[model samples]
Target: MTARALSARSLLRWLSLLALAAGCHVAPIAAQELIAHPSAEIATLTRNEARLYFTLRLKTWPNGRLAKVFVLPDNHPIHQRFTNEILGLYPYQLRRVWDRQIFSGTGQAPITVDDEQEMIQRVATTPGAIGYAAVPNEHPDLRVLQVR
Candidate 1:
C-alpha cells in the first residue's frame, strides 16, 4: 500500500480511539443526569429505607408515619427491569414469590398504577406515599426514594 494511504488509515484509527475514550469519560455523568431522581426536601430517603419502602415491608417511615407505596403496572418495562435486575426474579418467578408472601399474609404489596404519571400523582396527592417512576417523569409533586 502507498505511504499516504497508510498515514490516512492511522489517523482515522487514532481519531476513532480518541472519540471512544472521550465517550467513556463523559458517559457516567450523562448517565447520572439521566438516571438520578431528585425528591422533595421532606421526601428524602436513604438507600436502605428506599428498599424497605419498595418491598411493602416497611408500612411506615421511621418517623411513625404510614408508608404508602405506588407501583407501576405489571407490564411496564421499568417494572420488568427492576424485578429482573434488582430483585433477581423474572415475571413468572416474581409472581410465585408474591404468591408465597401473600399466602403467609405478611404484608400487602404496593398499589400498582397504570403509568409513571399516575403513580407520581397518586404519591403526591396521598400523604406518606412513595412511588416508582422514570427519572425523567419525576416532578416536584412526587418524591423519589433512593434504592440501596
Candidate 2:
C-alpha cells in the first residue's frame, strides 16, 4: 500500500483505541427508556446508587419501600446496554453477583422479563418496580427514572 494509506490506517487504529479507553460505545438511550412505577419515590439515581440497586445490594428505597428491580433477559440488547452503560457492569459480572446471591441465600436476583414490553408492563403494575425498555414509552402509569 502507499505510505499515505498506511499513515491513515495507523491514525484510525489509534483513534479507535482511544475511543475504547474512553468507553465510547455505550449508546445513549433517550431518557424515556429507563422506567419505574408511577408511585415509586425515586426520580433519579446517581451511578453508584444505580449500581447498588442492580447489584442487589440496595434492596429498599430511601422511604423504606422494597425496590423491586426487573430486567430484560441477559441476551436482550436493552439488557446489555442498560447493564453496561447505566450500571457500569457487563452481563456476566451482574450474573456472578446474582449467582452468589442465590447460592449464598443472603440476597436475590432481579426479576427477569422477556422483552421491553413486559418490562414496561411489569414495572408499571408492580408498584415499586424498575426496568428498562429500548424505546420511549407512553404508558400512563409508568414514569421514566433518570440516571445522573
Candidate 3:
C-alpha cells in the first residue's frame, strides 16, 4: 500500500481509540431515583429501610397505608440496577424473597411495570405507590424520595 494510505489508516485508528477512552472516563450518574406519589408520608429512607419495604418486610407506610411497590420486569437493566444500588441485593435474591413470601402465605409480590415511563405513571397516580427510575424532573404529582 502507499505511505499516504497507511498514514491515514493509522490516524483513524488513533482517533477511534481516543474516542473509546474518553467514553470510558465519563462519570456515571446515579443508577436509580426513588419516586413516589406526591402525598406519600415518607420523604427519605435509609438503604436498609428501603430494602425492607422493597423485600415485602414492611408492607405499610408510616401512616398505616399499604405500600404499593412497583418494579420493572426482572430481565430489564433498570431492574438490575435498582436492585443493586438501592436494595443492595441481586434481582434473583429479591425474587427469592418474593417467592418465599407467596409460598408461605405471608405476603405478595410487587406490581411490575413495563418501562420507566410506566413506572413513573403508576407511582405518580397510585396513592401509596413507590418505585424507582432514571432521574427525572420534579413533577407536581410525584415525589423523589432521597435515599439516605
Candidate that scores best on lDDT: 3
Error of 1 at 108 (Å): 1.2
Question: What ranges in model 2 sit over 4 Å off?
Answer: 1-32
Model 1 RMSD in Å is 11.6
For residue 131, model 3's alpha carbon misses the true position, in angstroms, by: 0.3
Model 3, runs deviating above 4 Å: 1-28
Worst 10 residues of 3 by lDDT: 23-32
User: What do the candidate models score in CA lDDT, each in turn?
Assistant: 0.56, 0.80, 0.83
**Better model by TM-score: candidate 1 vs candidate 3:** 3
The residue-by-residue lDDT of candidate 1 on 1-148, one tens digit each, is 3586568657856776887978853222111111111223344455445555566666765567776766676788867766543443455654564566678887666677887567666777877776555454446555444333
RMSD of each: 11.6, 8.7, 11.9
Tens digits of per-residue lDDT for model 2 on 32-127?
A: 367888667878889798889888899888887888999878888888888866776789999999999989998999998788778888998997
Residues 1-148 of candidate 3: C-alpha lDDT, one tens digit per residue: 3586568657856776787888854222463688887656889999898999899899888888888999999999988988876776789999999999989999899998999889888888999999998765477788888877
